[model samples]
Target chain A: MSSILKITDLHIAVDGKPILKGVNLEVKQGEIHALMGPNGSGKSTLAYALAGHPKYEITGGDIEIDGASLNELDANERARLGMFLAFQYPVTIPGVRVADFLRHAVTNRRDPDRKEGENLMPMREFRQELRGRMNELGMDPEFARRYLNDGFSGGEKKRMEILQMAMLKPKFAILDETDSGLDSDAVKVVSEGLSSLAGPETGVLIITHHERLLEFNRPQFTHVMLAGRIVETGDASLAHELHANGYTTVRERHPAEAAEEQAEREETLATV
Target chain B: MSTVTVNSAPSLPSGFTSDDFEVFLQSRVEPVWVTQRRRVAFELFQAKSAEELDPEEWKRIPARAFRPEKFSLTGKAAIGFDTAQLPLMQNRAEFEGAVVHVDGSATESRLTEQLAAKGVIFGDLATVLCQQADLLEPHFATKAVLPDTDRFAAWHGAFWTGGTVLFVPKGVQVDAPLYSLVALAQDGVADFSHTLVILEDGAEATLLEETASGSPDIAGLHVGAVELLVGKEARLRYVQLQNWNQKSWHFAHQCGRVEGNGSLQWTVGGLGSKLAHIHQDVHLDGRGAEAQVNGVTFAKDRQCLSYYTQQTHNAPDTRSDLLYKDVLTDESRVIWRGMIKVEPEAQKTDGYQRNDSLLLSPTSRCDAIPGLEIEADDVRCTHGATAGRVDVDQIFYAMCRGLTEHEAMHIIVQGFLQTVTDRIPVELVRETLDKAVEVKLGIGE
Candidate 1:
C-alpha cells in the first residue's frame, strides 16, 4: 500500500537557523505515526512544515500527498485538501463563540450542493449538531457557547482542539504534543478521541514526548527525530528505547552519523 | 422664460435667526415653563462658539474640513416611512417593547393612539408641549446635557424644529422599541432636532435614534441633541445608529442621567458621514446608578474624525464604563479622546474607559487620548488604548486554514469589531452592521 504522505529531503529553517535540515518520512493511511524527540529536535517544526506553516521556509523539500506536490499550496488550501493541525497550544480567541467558529469551518468544508441555498447552518440545527459532537467527546454543552478557548483550562483547550479535528474530519491530522500539560485522565480521553478518528483514509501524525501516550494509542510507525533530521525509524517499540536510553546515548552511539547524512543529502539535492 | 439651473441654492426661510425660536416658543398653548427654558437655552446657545480648530486635539476630525453652509435639506418625502409607528422590520419584534419613528422636521409619527392607552406617549415635542406640556417641561434638556457647550448645541437648542418626547409612566414596561430618525435632505440645508426620553420609576424601555440623509452625495448638516432621564429603579437602553451620507456633516450631543438604582445603556454605531462629532456624556447622579457606553466607527479614504466622551461618576457607589473602537483605512484618520471623572464626594466609584483602533493600511492614522480624573480617594478608575494592525500570527493561522490573506484579515477585523455588533438589540441591524463592516473592509461582493 502506498503512503498517504511522502516527504523526501525536506529541509526547513526559520530565521536562517537550521530546524529541519534534511528529513525523510512516510505516513500511510489509517496509521498513527509517532515522531518523538527531545526539545529542539524539530518534532513540532516537522509537523508545522508538513502543514505548510509560512515560517517553515521549505529550503529543499519534495512533500507529496499521494504523488501530488504540496509545497506550493497555502495553509488553507492544504486544509481544503484534507490537512488539519491542532496547535501545541491552541490560541485563545475572545468574543468569538466556539459554535460560530465551528459552523464557519464546517460550512467551508461542506460540498457545494450541501451548502446550496443554505450556507449558514441554522442556529437550531447547528446547536443540536454541536451538542451531539460535544457529547461524543465527553464535553460540556456550555463549552460551545463560550469564546473559542477563552479562559479554558489547558486540558479543556486540548479537548476542544480534538473536537475541531473530529468536526472537520480532515484526511490528514497533525496533533502537536497534545499530551503536554494534560493530566493522565485527560491524556487518556484525548488518546481515545484520536483512536476513534483513525480510519483507512485518514493518516495522523502525533508529535509527543511521552511513551505512555503511544502505549494508549499504539502507532503503526515510530520515528526518532534529532537535530532537525530523522536519525532512526522503527516500530512502536522505538518510543520505549528512546524513553529508556535517552537521546544522549543515541547521539553518542552515532555522533558523526547525522553530519554524514546531511552532506550526502546536500550532494544529492545539488545534483537534482 | 429663461431656462433655470437645477443647481441653484435651496430656498431658505425669510430670515434665519435666533428670534424665530422665541416667536415659535411664544405660540405654545401651555404654561411658560418650557418656553422660558427654550429662551434661556437659546441665549446660552447664541453665546457659545464653534469648536476651534485645535490641531493638537481635533486636527484629524473630518468635521474640521466640512463647509457648514453647503448642507441642504432632505427633499420632499424621501422615504415614505410612517414616522409614528415602529420602524423595526419583522425580525426585531421579539426583544423590543415599543418603537417610534420621526423625521428631522416634524414628528409625523403619532404612537400615542396605540401606546397612550397603555400610558405611553410617543409624539412630536411640539405636540407634547401643547398636550403633555406639564410632563414634558421637567425634562426638556434638564438632564446631563447642557446647551452652552458648543455651536451645534446652541444651534440645535435655538432653532430646533422637530423632536420626540417619550414619557413612559411609572411601573410600565414597554415591550416594543422607540425609534427617532433625523433625515437630512437637500444640499446646503441644516436640520436641528432633539429627543427627550423620561423613563419613570421602575419603568423599562429601549429608545433607538437613526440619522441618515436622502442621498449619498447631497451635502447636508445635522445638529441634533438627545437627553435621556432614567428615574429611580428604571432601566433604559438607548441606541444611536448614524449613517449620514458622505457629503453630510453631523454634530450631535447625547446625555443620560441615571437616578438612584437606575441603569442606562448607550450604544453608538457611526458608519457614514464626511465629518462627524458626537459628545456623549453620562452622569451617574444617584447612588448605585450605573451607565454603559459603547461606540464603534469605521473611517475609510480621506475621512477625518475625532470622538470625545466623558463618563462621570457624581454620586457615591455610582459606576460608568465607556468603550470606543474604530477601524481606519486608506488616508482616513481617527482620534478617540475619552475621560473618566469621579467627583470628590463620590466614594467607592468605579469607572473604566477603553479606546482601541485597528489600522488597516500604513497611511491610516489613529490617536487615542485616554484620561482619568479622580477626586475621590476610594475610587477605582482605569483607562487603556491600543492601536494596531492585524495580528500577523492570527492572519497566518487563518491563511494556513485555507483562507487567502484578504479573507484571513477580514475575519480578524470582523472579530475585532464583533463587540460592537453583538450589542445591537435588533438582528437586522447587526447583520447590516456586519455587511457595512465587510464593505468597509473592501471584501464584500
Candidate 2:
C-alpha cells in the first residue's frame, strides 16, 4: 500500500530551540506506527510540527500527504487535508459546546471528492454516528452538552479527544502524548479506540512513552526520536528492545550508526 | 451591604459642568407634574455640591461629551424596518388595557377613545395630569428614577411633553406589551419621553419600549426615563431597544423598585447612536426579591457607549445579578461600571456582577469597572470585569474551518456577545436583538 504520510529530513524549531532535526519517517495505510523516546526526545515536538502548530517552525523539511506538499497549509488546512491531532492537554473553550464544535469540525473537513451539489450527511445521522463513537470510547452522554473540555477530568478529556479522532476519521492522525497522564485502564481504552478507528484508509502515529500501549495496539513499525532527529527504526520488536535495554545500547554500539539506521528505515519503507 | 461610602473612587471632570445643563433644562418641560418634578429636581441636584462630583462620592460615569441638553431634538420621523413578514406586534392587543401611541415627540389624540371604555387612563403627560389627576398624583415620579438625577433627568422632568402615563389596576395583567415608537423624525429636535409604569401588587405585564431614528444629517437627543414599581409577587419585564441615528446622542435612566418577593428583569440593547449613556438602578426593598439586569452594546465608528448599573440589596436574602458586554469596532469605545451594594443588615444577600468587552479593532477601547460593597459578614458578593481583544487563535481556528478573516471575526464577536443575549427570555425580542447584532456587524443580508 502507498504511504499515507511521508516526511523527509524534517527540521523543526520551537521558541528558538531546534527540536526536530534531520528526521525521516513514513507510515503506510492500515499501519500503526508507535513513536517512542525518553523525555525531551522531541517526540511531542515532532507531532506538533507535523500538525502545523504555530509556535513550531519547520526550517528545512518536506511533509507530504499522499505526495501533496502540506507545508503550504495552515493548521485548519492541514486538518482539512485529512490530518488530526489528539492533544495531550486539550484546551478548554468555555462557551463552545462539544456537539456544536463536532458539527463544525465535520462540516469544515468534508471530503473533497464529494459532488458539488450533493449533501454530505443529515444532522440526525451525523449525531447518531457521533453518539456511537462516544459510546465506544466509554464517554458519558452528558459530555456532549458540556463546554469543550471545560472542567473535564484527565481521563474524560483523553477519551473525548479519542472520540473526536474516531469521528473525524482522518487519513492521518498524530496522537501527541495521549497516554501521558492516563491511568492503566484509560491507556487500554485509548489504544483500543485508535485500533477500532484505524483501517486501510487511515494511518495513525501515536507518540507516547508507555510500551504497554504498544502491547495492546501492536504497532507495525517503531521509531526512536532524540534531540531533534530520528536515531533508530525497526519492526515492533525494536520497541521491546529499547524498552528493556533503553537507548544506551544503540548509543554505545555506534554513535555514528544512528544516521544510517534512520536512512535505511526510510529507504525500506519507500520501496514497499 | 454596609452604608460605608466610597472614599477613593477615581474621578474625571470636564469643563461643561452640570449647572450649564441645568439652566437648559429649566426652559423645556411644560406639563404640571413634569414642572413640579423639575423644580424639586433642581433643589435636590443643586444641593449635590462639588463634593458629590468627586469620584469617591459619586461613582465614575464615562468620560464623554456632556452637552446632552444643548442638542436640539428634532421631532421623530417615521422609521421603516424590513422585518420581512414577521408579525408587527409581538402579542395580541389588550382591548381592556390603557393604550397610548407615541410617534417621536408627538402623541396621537385618539388614544383616549380605546382607553375610555375600560376606565384605563392613557394619555400624554399633560392630558393625564389634567384629566386623571387622582391617578397621576400618587404614581408620577414615585420610583427612585426621580428628577434629581443629573442634568438630563432635570430636563426630562421639567420639559418632557412626549412622556406616557399608564395606570394598570390591581390584579389586571396586560397580555400584550405596551409598545411605542419614539422616532427622531425631524432635524434638530430633542425628543424627551418618560414612561411611568406602576404594576400594583400581584399584577403581571411586559412593557416593550422601542426607540429608533432615521434621518442621517439630523442631530437629535433622546434623554428618556422609565420608573417601574413591581409590587409583591408581581413580575415585570421592560425591554428597551435603542437604534437611534448614528449622529444622535441618547441617554436614559431607569429605576425599578421590587417589593417583597417581586422580580424585575431589565434587558437593554444598544446598537446605534453616536454616544449613549444608560443608568439602571434596582432597589430590592423587601426580602426574597430578585432582579436580573442584562445589557449589550455595539459601538463602531468612534461611537461611545457608557453604562452605569447599580443593584442595591436592602433587605435580607435578596439576590441581584448583572451581566453587560460590549463589542467595539473601529474607533468605538465602551465603559461599563457595575456595582452591587449589600446593606449591613441585609444578611444572606447574594449579589454578583460581571462586565466583559471584546475589542474588534486596534483603535477600539473598552473599560470595565466592577465593584462590591459588602457590610454583612454572612453575604456572598462577587464582581469581576475583563477587557480582551478578539483571540487571534480562535479566529484562525474558525478561518481554517473555511471562514475568511472577516467571517471568522464576525463569528467570534457574535459568540462574545451571545453570552449576554442568551439571558433574554422573550423569543421575538431575542430574534430582534440577533437581527440588530447582524446589522451592526455588517453580517447577513
Candidate 3:
C-alpha cells in the first residue's frame, strides 16, 4: 500500500499567534505537490509544522501518516518515520564532516529502533554509498570530508540539502524553498537533482516561489495559500497562471481571505 | 616496603605545620643543596599559606571548605597496587621511556637503552637529581615555576615527593615520545609529583603525562608542578592529561620557557577533579621564540575548574597563540582568565589568545576573561573570550538528520572541541583525547 500524508484542518500558531488556520492537504506516494503563495501566507510555516518544529505549535487539527498521528513526535522521531525536510536555509554545523553526519543519519533512518551508542552502518558500506550519491549529483568526492555546510557558498548549501534528501530517501520529502536565494545555474542543478530523486516510491511537496522548479518537476497538484488557508487548489496550469500573472487576481477572487491577509500585513507593519 | 594509612584520625594537625614539614624533610634522603632549597621553600610556604590568596584569582573559586590537614604525605610507599586500569595513552603506543608513580613514590621507571646511550636522562626526579646533581642543580626549580610565585608553588617546592624528569643532551632528538603516570591509591594521601623537562640547544622531545586515581570514591589531593625549559632552536611538545576521580582536589603551577628560535607546544586536558585551579605561564624569553598553548576541559556534576594563564613575550620577533575550549554540564562551573603580556623590547611581536566555552545545561556556568598588557608600540596583540550554551538550532538540525537528542548533543560537543584538538599534532594525543571525551560523555567504553 502506498503511504499517504494527510493534513486535516491543521491550525498552527507561533508564539501564541495564529498563522495556519484550517489548512487541509493530502499527498500520496508517487505524486508531486506544489505549495505556492504570497509572502507571509504561511507556506514555510506549513513546511516547518509538518516537520515538527518545536516552535510551530499545532493548536488544532492533526497531521498523520497513513493513519498514525505525528502530533506527539519530535523532529528526530518524524525523521525516523521517513519524513524529511530539505530546509530553506540548511544549518551549518562546524567541525562535523559531511560523511560522519550522514553516516549517523543514514544509520538511524535505516534502523528506526536503533538506540544511542549502537553500531552505525559499517564505514566501508556507508562511504561507498555516499561517494556514489555524490558522484551521481556531480559533486566532488572531496566535499564529503569538509565540515557540514561550514563556509559553503549559497549554491553549495542548496545542493547539500538535495544531497541529504538523496541520501536519506525518505517516504515523504518536503522541499521548503530549496530553490530560493540561488542563481539560475544553481536552480537548474537543484531542479535536476530533485527530478532524479523523486520517483514512484516517494511523495514530494515542493514549497517554492519560482516556476523554474515546477517547470522541471511539474507538480500534479498546486495549492495557493492566502491568509493562512489554502484558498485555491488546481492543476499545473494554475501554477503557471499564478507565476505569470502573480497573486492579484487570486486575491480579488478570494476577497475575505485577502482582506485578512491585508489586515495581517498592516498589523505587522504597525508593530514594526 | 609496607603501606602506611594516614587518612584517618582528625586529631592530627589540621594543615601543613612546622612539625609536618620537618617530618616530611626527614623522610627524604638528598644532598645538602637540595635540603637548603627545601628549608627556604618551607619558610616561604608557611608565610604564604598564612596570607590571603589573591582575590583576583580566587574570587570565583570557593576554597573555604578545603581542609588541607585531612591529607598527609605517606611515610611508606603504597605496595602491590595495580595501575594498569588508569586510562589515557597507556599501552596505546610505543614509548622511548615510561615512568609510574603511585602515592607519591616511584613504582616503575624504564628507558630504552638506545636513548640512554645517547645522553638522554629519563627517570624519577629523586633518582635523576641524585645521579646528575651537578647537571640538574642549575635548572631545578630555578628557571620556570618559581617557588615564590604563590602558596601552591612554595608548598610543592618544599614537599614534592616523586615525579618524572626528562633531560635530552644538546643536538639530540628523542623521537618516540615518553610517558608518565601519576596514580593516587590511598585515601587522603597528598601526591605532590613534579615534572621537569630540559632540552638543550638544538634538541627535541615530546612527553605525555596523565594522572589518575586507583578508585572512583577515594579522596585524594594533588599539589603538583611542571617546569619545561627549551634551549635555543630546540622544540618541545608536552601534554598533561589530568584524569583524577571526582573526589580529588588538584592544584598545579605549570610553566614553560622558550629560548631563541625555540618552540613549545603545550596541551592540557582537564577532564576530572572535584575542584582544580591551575596557573599556567609561557615565556618567550629569547628572540624569535614561539609558543602554542592548547587546553581542552570538560566539567560536569558539581565540579569547579579554574585556569589562570599568561603568555609573556620578552624578546623581539616573538610569537604566542593560546586557545582553550571548555564544555560544562549539570551544575558545574568553569572559569578562565587569560592575559598576553608584551615587553617593551619585544617589538614586532605577535600574540593571540582566545577561549570559547559551550554550556550544555541551564544551570551550567562559565566565566571567561581575556586581557592583554602590551608595552610594545609595534606589536599585534589580540584576545577574545566567548561563552554560550549549545545552539538549539544546531541541535535541531542534527536531530532532523536522524540522531537522537543525546546523540546530537554528543556530536555537537565533539565538534565544538575539534577546533582545539586540531591544533595538537600528536596522533596519540588526539586519539586519547577523543576517547577521554567519549568516556566523559558516558557514551563509550
Candidate 4:
C-alpha cells in the first residue's frame, strides 16, 4: 500500500461559508506532521473534509490516497480504503458497549471483503487483544463494557479514541484537536499511547492549537496556518518558535498576505 | 365433546352483521352466563353506530382491515392438521410444556405429567371450561378485562375461540417456561382468541406466547383478549410476540391485575401485521405491588400499528413503569398513547412511562403521546415522549469504523431496539427477536 495522503489546492465550505481556502499539504508514511493554528483557522475543517463529511462540501481541488481520488467515496467506503478520522468530539451512542462496536470496526477495517452477519473476529482473540490494548493505554477494562463515549469524561473519550486507533490500525489516521479539553496528566498519557502506536506503516496528521501535544509526539515537520491557508512551514523548532512567540511572529512574517486577508474579511463584513 | 358451526362460511368483500351474531349464538350450547354475556356484548356491538364509536381516540385507526362477514367463525381452534406438522417455533427443548393452536383449533400440546401432578392446569380455554367450571365461572371476564368494554371487546366476547388458560395453584412454581403458539393457517379466517393466566398467592411462572400467521397473502382477522391475575406476592413474566403477515389485521385488549407485594413484567414485541390496534393496561391494586410494561416494535412497508396503554396505581405504595420503543422505515406509521393515573387513595404511588421512536424514512411517521393524571398529593408520576429520525453523527461514526452505510444504520437501529429486547430473559428468544428486527430492516439473513 502507498501510505501517503495527498491534498492539492483544497477548498471546503460549510453551508456556503468557505472555511478551507486553497490549502495544499502532503502527509507520507512514517511521518507525523503537525498543523498548528489559532481557532477558526480551518484545521478541524480540513480534517473533516478529508474524512468525507457530507456537510463539508469539497468545491475545489482533491484529496487522494495513494494515486486514487477520494472525492466520490462515502465515509464508510473511504473507511474501507484505510482512512480513519478521530473526531474532536466523538459522538455519543448510548446502549452500545465499546467492545462490541470496536469488534465490528476492527473486522470491517481488517477484512476488506468481510460480509455482513459474519463475525470478523472470534470472541477469545478479540477479548485478549482488546484487554491488552486497554492495559497498554492504562484504560480500565470496565470501560470496554460501558456505552461508546456515552457519559464519558473528556479524558476518557480521548483514551477511547486512542484505543480505537490501536485496534483499527488504519493506514492513514488524523487526530483532530484530540488534545483539547484534556488535562496535563491525560495529555501525557494519551500522547504516550499515540506515540507507542505510531510507526512506519501508518501516516498521521496531528491538528492542534498548541504545542502541548507536540511535546510528546515531537513532529518532524510543522506547518502554521492562518486565514484558512498554510502561511509557514519549518522544522520541529518551528513549534517551539510558535509556542515561545505565539502567532505574532508568524503573522509578521507574512504581513502582506495577512493584510490582504484582513481587508477581505472587512469587505465581506461591510457587504453583510 | 361438542362443536358448533356458526354463520355461513363465505369469502371476502362482505362483512358481519347482527344476523351473523345471532347465527353464531344459535349454533352454540354454552352456559347461561356465557350466553347472557355474549348477548349483552352482541347487543352493544349492534348498537354502536359509526358515529357513537367516532371518538377522537379511535380516529387514527383506519377502517377495519377485513369486514366481519368476509371471515368465517369456524369454532374453537380445531386445526384439521396436527400443529406439530407446522414449523412455527424452534428450540422446544427448554420449555416444560407447549401448546399450539392453528386455524381455530388446538392441534398439538405437551402438558408434562409433573405439572399436572402439581394441580397446574394448562390447555385450551374451551376444554378447561368444560372440565373446571368452578374455576372458570367466577374469574372469567370478571376482573382483568370486562366483556362489555367496546365493539372489539364485545365481539371477542360473543365469538372468541381457540384460546388458552394457564392456572397455577398456590405456592406452585414452574422452573421452565410454558410455551404456546396461536397461528392463523388459512386466508379469510377470523380468530377471536382469549389467553387467561392466573397465579395464586406465592406462585411463580413464565409464559412465552407467540401469535403468527401463514403468509402475507392470507388476509386474516384477529380480535383477541388477554387477562393476567397475579395474587398476593405472586410473580409472573409474560412474553407476547406477534408476527402476523402484512395481509392480516389484528386488534387486541390485554390487561393485568397485581395484588399486594406481587410483581408483573410484561415484555411484548410487535414485528408484523398490516394494521394493528392494541390496548394494554395494568392495575396495581394492592400495597407494595409493582408492574412493568416494556416492549419494542419494528415496522416496515405500509404497516400501521398503534398502542394505547394505561397504568393505574390504585393502591398505596404501588409502582408501575413502562417503556415502549419503535423503529419505522418505508411508509410505515406508529402511534403510542400512554397514560399513568394515581388514584386519590393511592398515596406514595410511583408511576413513570415513556415512548421513543426512530423513523428511518422521511415519509414515515410516529406519534408518541404521553399523559399523566395525578389525583394523589403524595405521588411521583412522570411521562415522556420523543419522535425523531436516526442520528446522522451516529451513522457517520459507525461508518468511520468500516461498516457500509446499510450496515452502520442496521447496527445502530439494532442497538436502539436492544434496550428492550435485551430484557427478554430467554437467550434463544432474545436472539430470535433480534434477528427478526434485522430482517424487517432488510439486513442480515
Predictions: Cα RMSD each:
6.3, 7.4, 3.7, 4.2
- lDDT per residue for candidate 1 within B1-445, as digits (tens), equals 1111121113222223455554656544545775666677766644443234334544445443445444433323445644334222223433223333233556256564556777988777766777877777667866556667655666576666667778899999886667666665555767777888999999998877677666667776677888999999999988877777777677788888898989998888877777777788888998999998888788988776667888888899998888888888898888778988999988999898898899988999988899888899998999999998866677666654545567666667777877766766666566656766776777543
Q: What is the TM-score of chain B in candidate 4?
A: 0.92
Cα lDDT tens digits for candidate 4, A166-197:
89888888999899999999888889998898
DockQ (Cα-based) for each candidate? 0.31, 0.17, 0.70, 0.63
Best by TM-score: 3
Predicted complex 4: DockQ: 0.63
Ten residues in sequence with the least summed lDDT for candidate 2 chain B: B1-10
- For residues A229-266, could you state the per-residue lDDT of candidate 2 as single tens digits? 77778888988898888878866655664554465557
The DockQ-derived docking category for candidate 3 is medium
Chain A TM-score for each candidate, in the given order?
Answer: 0.87, 0.87, 0.99, 0.93
Q: Rank by TM-score, descending?
A: 3, 4, 1, 2
lDDT score, residue A44, model 1?
A: 89
State which candidate has the highest lDDT: 3
- Indicate the worst ten consecutive residues by lDDT in candidate 1 chain B: B1-10
TM-score of each: 0.83, 0.80, 0.95, 0.92
